[model samples]
Target: MTATVVVGAGISGLSAAHQLATETSDTIIVCDAAPRLGGKLHRLALDDPADLDQGPDLVDGRCGDPALPFTVDVGAESMLARRPEGLELITALGLDDHRVHPTTARAQAFLDGRITPLPPSNMGVPTDLEALGGFLSDAGLRRARAEVDHEAPALAGDVSIGSYVADRFGDEVTDRLLEPMLGGVYAGQSRRLSFEAVHPGLFAAARQGGSLLAAAQQVAAAAKRSNDQSVGSAPPVFAGLIGGVSGVITALEDDLRSRGVAIRSSTTVREIRREPGVDHGGRFTLVTGPVPAPELITADRVVLATPAAPTARLLRALAPEAATALAEIPYASMAVITFVLADAELSGSGLLVPPGELPTIKAFTYSSNKWDWIADRAAAGFGAGTAVVRASVGRFGEEQLLQVDDHELARRTLAEARAVPGWQSARPLRTRVQRWGGGLPQYLVGHRDRIQTIRSAVAAVGGIAVAGAYLDGVGLPSCIAAARRAVADL
Candidate 1:
């Protein structure tokens, strides 16, 4: 009997197994349905000429050595530095010195048919009305400013972020500001997302019956004060490993293997059932592998660290209530198109495209400009004129948009990307498109209540716990935190 069985080999599951390895001398085994261990944390290699699929000869030795491959993250590229879990994990895995932060490049937003600096805000909620002048119309700006005088009644229960923000600052603020900001994270419409779940700090303030603008200001001020009071220079908002964020997964995998933990990829946990009156070796039995001749593994404890759908399915028999709640959580699909260009010169870290403002493209990250390492590596690997750029496509409820073949999708993305100012002259050397179906979980209205119900149901089932991006947030730090909490609960 396995002492502990972790179903799912994503960052959350791996982190849980890591925690379990340190806490108990149990026979731990991690299983993932996907062929690869790192679920969304994938690192793509850009070395093979066949993978290029287009553009000039990258293998030519004129620019740099042809032997070395240029690597970049295709999934999650960076983790939040403000959250300690990601950084702490890095340090614990002896990867502290390899940590890197984004350069001091201001992000820009394409508004009103032109590019402009993104205004200061606390996650899309404009703390200062003056900053909205560049994007918001005169009347829209007045409406946002008028929020100070409006009587904000105490918020009762949960509501969509778009509904509440529009009620206070008008529809323009929701469309022009909040939509793109929230879209970048959840890839979901703000009108359908939960206010309490998305912005808890503002939600807590709103429950007290006060001006939202004032609440935003106070929150921003408190954040500034906290940063200012920190020991040395203020920490960056995000951090990535020097090689790639996927390094964390590789490191964790190695560490777990060294400790005698078993990781099984391409192995699906078809079902999990509670054993009756079995308390000696294990209490749960897991059915896995091919349906023709399934294998059973018994475990004393289990951690369900998969996405909403899979987790819900596995918990159907074990915890029906939790399964039902988990099924209610929806996910969004997206694609990231990475381009290596020759003689390209782009400014700023990236550009955000509000919904309806662009076709096929949601955002563009001038990765070579944002990360000095990418630039240095590009020059050393490809040539002095090479630049790396990533374009994000698709959003919540936009699955049909990504149905096209990779070549077609890349074509559409590249065409739209070139239309943006400063990117027109870019000559593509190579292009790769990575599609993530139902990658990000959406936090819809009443998400807080749903989470509570799921947690309550899971807690009642002895020796079982659930952890994933859907529980708290869709960030690396959040997943890590959830994993730790799940282990603690077990």
Candidate 2:
């Protein structure tokens, strides 16, 4: 029987493997170093069994669309509805019922030892020069705006996002606003990220306007127009599961299994080799290990969906050109500490933090207040507000990831949170820590060219491909979409 070997049992791998099984009638085996699946898409049912949350809850992109779950995406909360791949998958999977939106509860960024509302301008683009900075001088803001272009650049070349931002807006904007914003997104230092790859739109806009500041103004106005159109939209919220973030995962995994998809957890694949055969070309062989020292399963194709580092290693022998290109991408480790408190604690909405606000906390999410899942628990409290707030330890590779243990991190977060006027009254009902050593992938400025080369180099190989958040967009929608793209090739 023809089979497909998929490395990494994460969502991307799993989804592609499932498609391979259904489309080609091929037996598919998904392998990962970890016992469980889901990659960065994690759902949790903490000490409170009733409440389910996304650690650092990822937000949903279909914030206003109905005909779905009215998804309250709080954990890892983000969606690139702009992308086509994910939306297509949702329709294919018949998850139209699962789609939904969560309440944003207003976002704010902390910097210079104070919390300020992040401008609600489109895509965080500054519409007016006055909106440039509490940090930059008037002249600096004007100069920065004069440099921005209004269109996004293509993936034809490579440039550091820092260089692009500096050339367009000056060093102050790059260091303070953009760097921190990107840090929160990619968890990598901006200097290393390529601007052409990461923010193509901003790059093009800068080129058009001769400055990012000017591009921001035009983009901001356009964005405002879009926002006005979406104002009275239905669901008008971010999407998530009815219970906790895990609810959807549990349901989806079980559904996949019901369709005859077998998930073998805690398994590892030592290596993938080509089996020379005349029956149907050369079959791809996967050497099973940690089970048998050298037992092998031959397959028709293979999908390398692991993180960039491991992917680089796997393709080294089969497609060295592709492997080397894959190796160029870098990763940043991250840790999350979740503090679930009673209603008496969380006084209001959530908060964001800009870069340079160090030594204590990086970002905090008012879980109980943002989504109905946690809010229901908060409402159940002793006539006061108790909520779950997540504190991220590192953005630009901070020491907190290495320096603090669970208790210490908790203590530090609690104390630092008190410094924020709204959350001072909040205390944890339960606490937990989730650390991802190589959790997030940083998209550097040269990222596009490097990835393009990697993809091109790998394409020369037959029946082999790669897909993940790192390849496409860096959000849930992107991940889902990437998985679908891999399936199309199969």
Per-model TM-score versus the true fold: 0.96, 0.83
Residue range 1-490, candidate 2, lDDT tens digits: 6667777776677667656755766666677777667767665544332222221322111111122221222246434454445445555556657565556567677666666766533233345555656655567666666654434454345677665666656676666666666766777667777666566666665553344555666665664567667664332424544454434345446656766656666666667767664333367777766553667767677788888888888778788987887777767666677765542344335555655566546577766666665565444432245455777767545544556665665566666666666655554555566667777777866677777887787666777788876886677666666766777765
Q: Write the per-residue lDDT of candidate 1 for residues 1-490, one digit (tens) a residue.
A: 3489999999999999999998888999999999989888998876544444643322232333568766899988999998889999999899998899999997898877789888888788888889889688999999998998888888778999888999999999899889888888888889999999999988887777778888888888877778768845677999998778998999999999999999999999999987887653348999997899999988889999999999999999878999999999999999998887876667899988888888868888889888988888888877786888889998899999999988778777877877788767777766778889999999999999999999999888878999999989989999999999999988
Candidate 2 matches the true fold with a TM-score of 0.83
How many pairs of residues collide in each model? 0, 62
RMSD (Cα, Å) of model 2: 6.5
Error of 1 at 77 (Å): 0.8
User: Could you tell me which 10 consecutive residues in candidate 1 have the lowest summed lDDT?
Assistant: 55-64
lDDT of 2: 0.61
